[model samples]
Each structure stands twice: as structure tokens, then as C-alpha cells.
Target: MLIRNKALFNKGLMLMGSFLCVFVSLFLPIWGGHGNGLDAADNMFNRLSKGSSYFIPGVKEDALKLEGKSVTITVKVKDAELAPRAVENLVKAGATAEFKDGAITYSGDLGKVLGAALIDADDLFNNRGPAVLERYAATEKNAEKTIVKAWWAVLDPSIKELQKQKLIQEAKVVGQVNKRGLEPGYNFYGINSEKVLDNVLPLVGLLAFYVLYTMWYGYAIFDMFAGIGLGMSKPKTKSEA
Candidate 1:
């Protein structure tokens, strides 16, 4: 009955449009926004349980495989120097890890492996990963600067945390920026999400639409109800006489 009238129908349509925007946003290709990293963080355990090795990229002879509640993760470092630390990290992750023949292998509870992988991924985004990855990726003259720059670019969306790590002197980052042929341009994560559509927009948009729809139709509905009440209160017409 409420939607029978034109005004009420239009209000209902606007309310539905708002919900449509929210529904579409969920599957939209938003790279970074709050949806990518923070939402992932919130559902980390559930995501892990579903068995996606999101943090680790590529397939080594040893890849992190999840089966039931078990997990196996392998980390390969370009520098043998990083091997010890890699194993140590896995240990901290509650995995039985061993570093031998240039790679570290971790096997244990999926939760622990995933937790460690997430920590390492965050560490990478925070500059620790990029700084180290570029060293292996760079070989050409002045290529180190650009390669690292690209990695840093991917990590740039999370720059606030990178600044706090202090493990690599800020001076080095500055020096790399000044190096010749440095053109940072990789966005591995959802870096463009905020400009187009943000995760928070859905909830906020839904609320705004509901409020606006009420503003458009609230009085109209009340008026209809009031009219009905008044009709009942007054004498009824005798068969349309």
C-alpha cells in the first residue's frame, strides 16, 4: 500500500538504489582502500582457514600448502645472510622450520604459518621486504635503485608503517630516491581503491540513503495513516451516497 503512490514509489526506488550501490561495491575491483588490507586483517583467521596463501607469492619447489589444520611454508632468500633470520621468523610463528640449501621450510599448524606469513607480509609492506627484495632483484648498473623503488612503490600505500620501522636508515631511502633512473610504479596491492570506491562508502552510503528515503516518504506514510484513522473516526459514507 505504501508503494502504491508515485511519491512513495520514488522514495522506495532511491532507497533501493542506495542498497544497489552498496551491493555492487563489494565485488568492484578496488585494490587497496580499507577493504584490502584492514578488512583482510580483520578476517585473517577465517581467510587462513579457507587455505589461501595470500601473503606468499609464486611457487617455489617448497610452497606453503594448507591441508586440513596443517600448513607448510617455504621462504627463499636471495642472500644467504637472510636465511638464519628467516628460520627464526618461522620458529616465532610456531612452526618447525629449517634453513638449508638456500631456503627455509616451515611446517606446523596452519594458524601459526599463516600468522607468520601475515607478519612477514606486513613487514615487507613496511619497507623491510622491499629493502631486502630489491637487493636480489637488482643487478644492472643503477638498476638497484629503480627495482627497489618499484618494490617500495608497491609498499607505498602502507608508508606510514614503513616510516616507523627504522631498521633501514631513512637516509638510505632518501639516497635511493635521488639515484638516477628511479621511477617507482608498482601497485601490487589495491592502491587505487580509495579514489574510486572505498569500503566504508557502502555502509555510509546505505545509512545516508535510508535517512534520505525516510525524509522523502516519512511524512507521506504518516499522512496516509492519519487519513485512515480520521476516516474511521468520522461517519462512513452510506454506499457512496
Candidate 2:
């Protein structure tokens, strides 16, 4: 085939090189929230996403000794509409969730569950106006009033302190990383189809180079073959006869 049609064969080789360039460009990895300078935050998200359970030196033993059994931390929010959403959020963040008695039952590590429940419940009310959230926080609606179920009391202050310090966004991303209703492109650490598109641009550049090189090399070879054919077809000189 090469002898019969050198030009066509060279063009075919150039076209094939373009595919290689596109393949690599689209799949190149880029930094993401999972490990892109967010490992601690990401780990927190994973832990909370599984369940807020954690090991304290003595809390588990104390709960066994004092409470007479394993205790399930729970809370009730005032808004019925937001209550169900908060329950769903808790479940996604890795805790057991049930809606009962106008409340959310989240059985997990107290601090972790406490943080998620409080932050998320209020997140539902965030749009009503800052004044409304301010009233909720000021009144301590985030805590269970009874001391016996006060497993979450400590986190109440800590969360407020963070809010006081204006670390609200960082404070919540731990659980928010795995929440529903995220922005369309908020893919945590997973590579989305959009990222694959970025790779396409790189591949296009590589394929361009490949195509250009193939065209030059193919033309050179084809031109050389054509010259040989022309010489062979010429009539014999009189001197040789």
C-alpha cells in the first residue's frame, strides 16, 4: 500500500497521532478539597459523615458508669419545616437520625453531633435575616436545657466562640462538605466531568503538535517517493544507447 499510495499512508499516520494528545489532556489530575491543603478538614468531614462517634479518654466509661448505659445525644429545634431537613442533614453527616416529638434524634459523638445539628438547624433559618439567628443563638436554643442530657453543652460555647471570632464558614465546612443541596459544582474531592473537560484543552495542544509533525514528515517522505517515480518514468538518454 505504501508503494502504491505513499501520500495517503502518511496522512493516515498524522491523523492517528491526534487521538493520543486528547486522551492525556482531559484526564490530568488537579488539586481537590480531599487532599488539596484540606486534609484535616476533609478528615473531619469523613469522620462526621460516618457518624460523630469519637474516643475520649473516659467519656464512654463515664457514660457506662453514670448513665447506666450507652447514651444517644439528641435535640429538638423550634421550626417544624427546618426540623426534617436538619434530621436529613444529620443522617448524611454519619449519625443515626429520626424525627420524633418535634425534634431530631442524632445518636453520635456528642460534640460532633451537637455541632452538626445546631449549625444545620440554623442554616435552615439563615435566610430569614441575621437578627433571627442572633436571637436563636442568644437564647441558647441550641442546647438541651436538662443537665443530664447536657452532653452537648460544651460545644455550645465553642461553636459560639468560633462564630464570635467569625470562623463560621470554616467551622461548618467539616459537615457541610458532605451535605445535600450543595452548589452544582461542589464535588468535594471527586473529579467531575467539568474537570475532564479542562484536560481536553491540554490534549488539544499536544495533538496539534503531533499532527503538525506527522504532516511535515509524511509530506517529506511522499515528495521523495514522487521524485523517484518521475525519474523512473523518464525516457532513456541517447548517450546510453
Candidate 3:
């Protein structure tokens, strides 16, 4: 009887040990890794989005919010000759252009007149090619400035159109006018800690349940074996004993 009890106790212990090993090896690590990975991803995206907004400045606002206001146009011209012509054209149409460093700026009320002026400038650049552009360069170094100038030249018309349609008011053109690009950042719409936790909590719960179930299964199996051993070790009967 004593021997049988000892055997039963050992079997129970073995079952429990097996359950713990399986539970820890399979479910616990997976649960941990999954939760951590999700957290890291959310954090990364949040940082990227915030950084973009900070660096780009004013990108968070609607594009059409600037409609009907006075604006300043800045450009970098490589060709000195084209610069004069560009400035002359702008001045003739009641828009002012000034050159400082290597850039030209046209500042005025962004009304229909300015818009029409931009359109005419666009046509001149598009149709005349390099020949018309060559006349504007003051030095050989300015030759390379054509592309950027042409780009600004083209954008003028679009800005004017936007003004006419009341899409954007009071515009400021900075950087290379022709080289328009998005500011750096991420623009995720609806991500928050609560949302992230909601998605992850279920996996964690499942893992806990699995661990508990494994432990219980081990105990149950041990109990069954112990009961069987106890029954077998009982004396047969009075006569036999």
C-alpha cells in the first residue's frame, strides 16, 4: 500500500512537470513576443508621423485654406538673362519680382491679374524652349539654373488657376518653386493606445488560458493514474491475505 501511494505521488508530479514545460515553451514566449512586437510597431509609426508634421510645417491644414490672400513667390533662377525677362514680365503685369542671392520672389495680391500673369509666363517658357531661356542668363554658371526657373515658370499658371477658382488664397512659394514635394512624416488617421491594447489583450488572455489548461490537464492525468494504482495494490481478500 505504501509503495503504491509513493508511485502515485511520483506520477502526479511528473504530469505537472510536463504541463509546465509545454505551457512555458509553447504559449508563454509566443504571447510575449507578439505583444511586444505590436507595441514597437505602434510606437514607430507614431514617431514618424509626428516628426513629419513638425518638420514640414503647416502640412496638417487643408490645401485650399489659403484662398484669395496675398502671397509671396520665391524662386531660384540659374540663368541671369531669363531672370530679367521673368522680372520684367511680372512687373509689367503689376506683380513685383525681386532678386536676392540666387532666388527671385514675386509678391502681390494673388488675384486674377497675378493669375493671368502666371499663365502668360507659363506659355512663354513652355513654347520658347532653351533659346528664350538663354537670353536671361547673365553668366555661364546661370545656365544650369534653367530647369528650376522653368519649373517655377510652369507652377505660376497653376497657382493662378487655383486663385481664379478660389481654391487657395495667400500662397507663399518657398524652396525650389518647381521642386514641390511632400513634407516628411506619417499620416495615420486613427491609432491610439486603447486601440492597440484592444487588439493585443485577446492574445494574452488566450495564452494564460492555455497555460492554466495545460497545468490542469497534467494534474488530472496524474490523479487518474494514482487512483488506478491504489486500486490495484489493495489486498485481494481475507482468505487470500
Candidate that scores best on lDDT: 3
Number of backbone collisions per candidate, in order? 2, 3, 16
Candidate 1: tens digits of C-alpha lDDT, residues 177-215: 222111211222212222212345654655695687566
Select the stronger candidate by TM-score from 2 and 3.
3
Mark the regions of model 2 whose C-alpha exceeds 4 Å error after superposition.
1-71, 111-241
lDDT of 3 at 226: 70
Which runs of model 3 end up more than 4 angstroms from their true locations? Answer: 1-68, 118-151, 154-241
lDDT by candidate, in order shown? 0.41, 0.39, 0.46
TM for every model, in the order presented, reads 0.25, 0.21, 0.26
The pairs that clash in candidate 1 are 31-190, 32-190
Residue 235 in candidate 1, Cα distance off native in Å: 92
Local error of candidate 2 at 69, Å? 15
**Cα lDDT tens digits for candidate 2, 11-42:** 54555455445444434433344343235334
Ten consecutive residues with minimal summed lDDT in candidate 3? 181-190
Cand. 1 TM to true fold: 0.25
lDDT by residue (1-241, candidate 3, tens digit) is: 2345665676776777776675566543353535443454445456444333332223213222332555566666555556665665556546777767866787655453334333333333233324334544434543323433543453444455445545443333422122222211112222221333444565466568668876688575756567456443556676764
lDDT of 2 at 55: 23
Candidate order by TM-score, highest to lowest?
A: 3, 1, 2
